[model samples]
Target: MPKSKFNVGDKVRLNKRAPGYYGHLLQRTRTIISIFYDDEKQGNTYELGARGRGGSLGFFRSYMLSGVSPAQASKIGRPKTKRSYKRR
Candidate 1:
């Protein structure tokens, strides 16, 4: 299997050429928290998270996200994991 374009913990930005519907996300840098592959379509979808925000924004196609520089990733830092409130 080929390697995915973006990996977990990698920072990415929505493609500038993406549709206007994604305009709200254009300026925000998001981190890749998880990836989902669809066998039927043979494509990858990513779950994104923003710094300082808990939980993920949503899933997006690989084509919609672009890789940011490692420097930029460092600046964005990692997304905070959601804590489980339920008792064991």
Candidate 2:
């Protein structure tokens, strides 16, 4: 209904409201992949992501993930990735 605060290339950190929510166990900065709305929760989806040594993190989605915050700029390893997503 309103404009989201984050953009696709922005770096961010996870903000867990409840306890025991592991959000891909990411402690480093994750880039905002995309934003969407889920009718079930009545909130915006903040799809965050990061590059890892093996593959990457934050590829999976979760309803429990509350939101994300700005984080320090860091290396976005591997330059390019084969992964991509589109809104259907």
Best by lDDT: 1
Worst 10 residues of 2 by lDDT: 58-67
Off by over 4 Å in 1: 72-88
What local lDDT does model 1 show for residue 35?
91
TM-score of 1: 0.68
**How do the residues 4-45 of candidate 1 rate in per-residue lDDT, one tens digit apiece?**
988899999988666678667788788999899878778888
Measured against the true structure, the TM-scores of the candidates, in listed sequence, are 0.68, 0.48
TM-score for predicted model 2 compared with the true structure: 0.48
lDDT of 2 by residue, 7-68 (tens): 66666655554234564564556666777776776666666554545333543234434335
Q: Scored by CA lDDT, what does every candidate get?
A: 0.81, 0.56
How many backbone clashes are present in model 1?
0
